[model samples]
Target chain A: MSLKPKTLVDFSFQALKANKLRSFLTMLGIIIGVASVILMIAIGQGAQAQVMSRVKALGSNVMMVLPGALGRFGAGSEGTAQSLTLEEASAVARLPYVANVAPVVRRAALVTHGANSWTTTITGTTPSITAISSTMSTVEGRFFSPADEKSAAPVAVLGQTVWQNLYPNGSDPVGTTITIKGVPFTVIGLLQSAGASMGGNNQDDFVYVPLKTAQIRLFGITFIGLMEVQAAGQKEVTPVINEVTALLHRLHGLPPGAPNDFTVRNLSQILSTAQDISGMLTLFLAGVAAISLIVGGIGIMNIMLVSVSERTREIGIRMAIGATQRDILNQFLTESIVLSLTGSFIGIVLGVGAAVAVSAFAHFPTPVSSLSIVAAVAFAIFVGVFFGYYPARRAANLNPADALSYE
Target chain B: MSAPLISCQELTKSYPLRGMEIKALNGVDLAIEDGEMTAIMGASGSGKSTLMNVIGCMDRPTGGRYLLDGVDVMSLTKDELAHLRNRKIGFVFQRYNLLPRMSALQNVLLPLVYAGVNAGRAANRALAALEMVGLAALAGNQPNQMSGGQQQRVSIARALINDPQVILADEPTGALDTVSSAEVMTILKELHQTRGVTLVIVTHEADIAAYCERMITMRDGRITGDSIIKGKRGA
Candidate 1:
């Protein structure tokens, strides 16, 4: 006589119900494993997404040329001898693929307005710096005009942080005088807040001044620090970088075999690299979590083995009552699968809830993907079937007489 | 006229223990007709249980042929033997063997479940079987909550659920008190008398054997005597 599917299910449920605590305890391993897997993946992906967004905000189709070679560890330290200059930046700006070039000179200095004082990085660049960074905008007054750079005017634009620090009452700083390194500079405009960028640097914690003013007036400097170059479009970035590299080598009169004194880095490449690293991190974490799932599977196998031995007499009784080997096998296998699936369901709920909670309270991004949920469920089933087979087969293969007479 | 309900020829069974073979059954030939109430009487190691197991198709003989309801039992596969047991033979164990977790009704319906009866009809038949044993009132009670006699009755109900031709009882009352034992025997006798089911009881007790119409005595894995009691007390 063949047992119906519903009857089989009922039998499994009854057996599991017989030892509720044991069943739940056995399921705990799976629940923890699945939840951790989902949580780890969410965290990993969230971090990747955060870094990607921050990198993308750096600007579209842009590259930064620094005064040193790209080191094995990271971006090289600036060379003692300045390798970038305003004339070379203009030459890059003349390239067919080049859209804009901003020669920058940066230094940290004390700025004071009234009794308020703040230490912030002072950036000296042409007005094209505004055109180079799409996210940069003057929220209030005007930016440095060409006349300001030519005249070496003592004028400055306050970043959001500098403005707020100098004027704690939220008063507008535009058209006010603020001293930079004891040199008086009139505030021309207040830039919009750009939040934090990659490397945890506050993008809005700087003061902007004209390049000539910074070079001749604030700190005597002959050569620029870096060049921020924007390409004509997305497709022109690679070509622009290569042309800039060749132009720099020729303009600097370096030998063909000599390593570049200046390093050219693509913003998009950095973005993709960050994505790849975070993606690997996500995979590695998920893999570690998957190991726990396997451990949980082993836990299932252990409990199922114990259950089979404990119920040997029951197996015998069922066999004597005309239960086929297949019937016994199916019954035990179904019990384990039900157990794991139940755990997986609970894990999904807990994992998703935890991700949402973390994102809400901890201010961490944790995006739960449906694909992860589906994959988690599928893996749980596979684990159940794979681990449960041995014990179930052992149950089915028992000698009815021996099992019946087993004490 | 037709073949006996159970037939065995030169039946032999042995087990290997510690590098030596121990014979449980030694070339026994036996047969029983339909509608017979028989008891196999023997001491602890006389192989009465082994014979009962082979006759019930729960085990295979080492060297012999067994036929149940005219079907060759020795040649059947494990699944086919299970199906045969489900359709042609029912078991009543000494401990009642009622799944302790289930209610009486559920226990009684177990055989019908194996028989692939639909839930509605299976339940009806199980209730009828339980009613036959006079435990219908306790149908919803678990075995642990019932008296030994009641649990044995539930097992009898389970055995009878599929309406098999034969019921094999292995010391069905061994775990019960005298009164409970008598109550269980009364139910068995009733089923045998009213339904004409062939009943085989394996027991070491002479009193329990006396309830059967025919008693077969065994010694040393071999049957020594077979006799019909002229006036069986209950039959």
Candidate 2:
């Protein structure tokens, strides 16, 4: 019938409307499949974005030297616990690319202020801690001076989380005395809230004290936990790591071919690893969703076969009038494509709605991308053509006389 | 004087039944001139319908040569055959095979659409065809909404929309009552006289055969009789 694409599409719409329920039922599978794929992609993108923000919060030029054989999972400290003492921290600060270093000693402790008591992590470090860590900034009063650290003074800095938990009424905690494990330390400063990290830990849920006071008076531990190192620039982190590794190897007297005792994890490496993980997650989910879409395509094929069988006489009539085999193929293919494209459009709306609902109600971020939407629509068209071809060919190949005479 | 509009030399069609060959048309040799209204009359199983199908390009002859307007029918490709059918020949079925959902005007426009006529001009052409069939006022009526006679008229309009050289009808009034059949026959006669369209009708009724200028009778898949009528009944 001259194979006019638009006219065939119009005919297809009319045919689909002739059996509205069947058309809608055929579209249901595609709707669900597309919606699920879109939702999964949105979740994956949101997680990647959150991870990037969290890593950026740790500062781009910073590296943490943990005192143990820390694996990717962050829990491989079963062997002899490696320690990054203050001496080693100073040794790292002597490296060529080193800018600042802070040797930290952390332990969970119960603190009391008047009648209020709360359990939170207590950090012991030097004034360089503020310089090396991007997450910390004094909003009230001031950080304890290096003089305070040298004198082993009983001065403390309260994190915003600890202040909120202890005070709760917005009362100023500066100049107030708080006892840490029976040792009274007067609050000298307040640290700004840094929110949660990618690992979902509150960065502000801690108090800072002098390293010597924490070591000699509070916990009685001489060893520091870790060293926070900042390079002079972003490009200097790798060189600083190499220098620190060599210096530590020499200090520990490790001979050649000996495995290093500590792990140096840089922010960029972790960020890239996180992106790969999330990207794979998105791909896996999309693959699973595509399987369902294939199944949906099969559903369309089955119904199209049935439609062709039911309309055998109609096909014969069209052939008798003037329609060529290609014309018949185009007509049925157009019908199937119209079905899937319409289903995909509706599915997009439903998918976006579902994603937004999840984000709002569950407080999880979901980012909807235009690329995914466009991909979904293109996939739907492919499914229609891939699955619709066989049935359409069958219809077009029918003998006109037999079809016309068919009951 | 010139080549006939339709010519067949020893045309044959066969079907396989239980590993045995059943010949629907053993051999058919006939010539139909342009502007002639002819009727092929035979009882059931006489292959009259088979000849109509072959002539309408709805089926191909198994063996022999068929020429429609000097063009070799057997040599045309499927798409070319479809184009020939769209441009040179039209058919009217017994059951008035109008698409059940479409209105009469849309049914008439079907051929024009298949012929690649422009959209704006198709409606006017279809309306003219409907007027020719005296169904112009019923242009918006669907097939099911109209009576059997009106549906057949709509189909006739559809066949006429392309203004083909030949119009083929297979027991065109078989499903209609007496009055409706007479009305349909009158329209066919008027079309043949005024438009000079070559008409080929397949029928078993002698009364229906009496309306045409020539009568060709078939029996046992071969022509039994061919005669020119001195006085056609309808005109």
Candidate 3:
């Protein structure tokens, strides 16, 4: 005679209830393991999403040509070197497959509007910067016109962060005058807010002026800082890069096989590189967390082994009454599965709660995927069955006569 | 005329202990017809408990030709033997082997659980068995809360739950006081008289053995005597 499945499960619950402390202690390992798994994955995915948003803000099918070679960490310190020129930017812009070019020269300066003053990056670029940066747009008034750039006009555009800092009263600064390094320029527009980039730099914290105005009036510098180049289409990015590289090589008079003075970095390449690093980090964290689960499984096995020996006489009594080896095995197996699944359920709740708390307090984007939850639960069951088998088998294999006679 | 309810021919059981083969049972041949109440008396290691275990289907004999209800016990697999034990043989231990965590009623219904009985009917039958043993009022109490006699009665009710043909009691009253022992013995005798259940009790106590009609004496690993007490026959 075999027991019904429902009866077996009931028996398991009763047995677990007999020793509450030991059961919870055994489940603690699993709880910690599951919680960390979910938390680590959430953090990893959040960082990845942050990187993706930064790439989106930087626009697509684009590349940046900066002075000097790319450094080990990122953009080289030689960025301030006067190597790139407006003529070189125009030359690259005329290349086939190149769509728009925005030559940029930037410097941090203290800008004042009325009594309010703020220190922010002052960027000087042509009107084509609006076409090159997909996120850049005027939220008030208008961007500086091509005619303003040609005449080196003393008109300025305020980024959202700069506008808020310089005009804390929220009054329109479109017709107001702002002084940058003691030079007065009329505020002609305000750019929409773009938040922060992957490098944690404020994207909306700059004041824009005409390229010629900054070159001739503000900084007295003749060379441009960098060039933002956009491809005609997604498929033309590589061709555009190759053409730009050749054109720059000829313009710089660099011999063939000589490393060029400028660094041409593809935006998508940086995006994929960021994604790879974060993905590896997620896997590494998960691997460490999985080890804890296995450790938890081992803890279960240890406790179950103790339980089996402790219940030898009880097992004998059941056997004498009519329970078969399979029944005994199933009873213990069910107990362990219940233990792990209960732990996992609590872990899921705790993990999700912790994710929300981190997002709320730390301002990190942590989207707990349903897939991770599913995977954690499935893995917990596997751990329960895998580690619970040996002890259950030992219990099932006991000789009834000897077991009954055991003290 | 018909085959005995339990039959044993040349049954032997041995185990290797410390590089020596120790014989627990040696070449014992016995039979008990349906409705027979018999007692086996022996000192420690006299093979009576071994014979009881063999008959209870809790242990297999190293060599034997045995039958319970005309089915060859020696040929049955482990699971089939368990099923046979559930269907035909019941066991009552000296320590009143009721699970400590379960209530008295749950203890009584243990065999029916393995017998695949439905819960509602099983509970009713368990209460009925408890009532017969006069412990129905204490059905919800765990074994630790009950007296020795009450615990033994609960175990007896457990043994009777499946309505098996034979009941094997090994030192069933060894752990009880004189009053509790008498109470247990009276219950067993009443069940045997009223239901015609075959009863096999293994005890060293002479008074306990006197409750049975037939008594068998064992020495070492073999039976020495088998006889019906004249006055106690069918008493």
Q: Judging by DockQ against the true structure, name the best candidate.
A: 1
The residue-by-residue lDDT of candidate 3 on A1-407, one tens digit each, is 56777887898889888999998999998898898889889998998898887786787698999888666777654345677999999999888888999999999999998899999999999999999887789989999999999999999999999998998989999999999999999999999988877767889999999999999989998899999999999899999989988889889999999987788888998899889988998888888988998999999999999999999999999889888999999999988898899899988999899999999999999989888888899999999999999999999999888888888
List TM-score per model, in order: 0.85, 0.84, 0.80
Give the per-residue lDDT of model 1 (tens digit) for B1-235.
Answer: 6799998889999999999999999988898889989999999999999998898888889998888888889899999998988888899999888887899999888877887888899889989998999988999999889988889999999998888999999999899999999999998999999999999999988889988999998888898998888534343
**Per-residue alpha-carbon lDDT of candidate 1 for residues A219-292, written as tens digits (9 for 90 to 100):** 79878999999999999888998999999999999999899988898898788888899999999999998898
Best by lDDT: 3
Which scores higher on TM-score, 1 or 3?
Answer: 1
lDDT score for candidate 3 against the true structure: 0.90
The count of residue-pair clashes in candidate 3 stands at 0
Model 2 chain B: lowest-lDDT 10 consecutive positions: B226-235
| C-alpha lDDT (0 to 100) for residue B219 of candidate 2 | 94
Residue pairs with colliding backbones in model 1 are none
Interface RMSD of each: 1.1, 1.5, 1.1
Docking category for candidate 3?
medium
Judging by lDDT, tell me the better candidate of 1 and 3: 3
The alpha-carbon lDDT assigned to residue A70 of candidate 3 equals 62
Give me the TM-scores for chain A across all models, comma-separated: 0.88, 0.86, 0.81
DockQ of each: 0.65, 0.54, 0.61
Candidate 3 residue A381 Cα shift, in angstroms, is 0.8
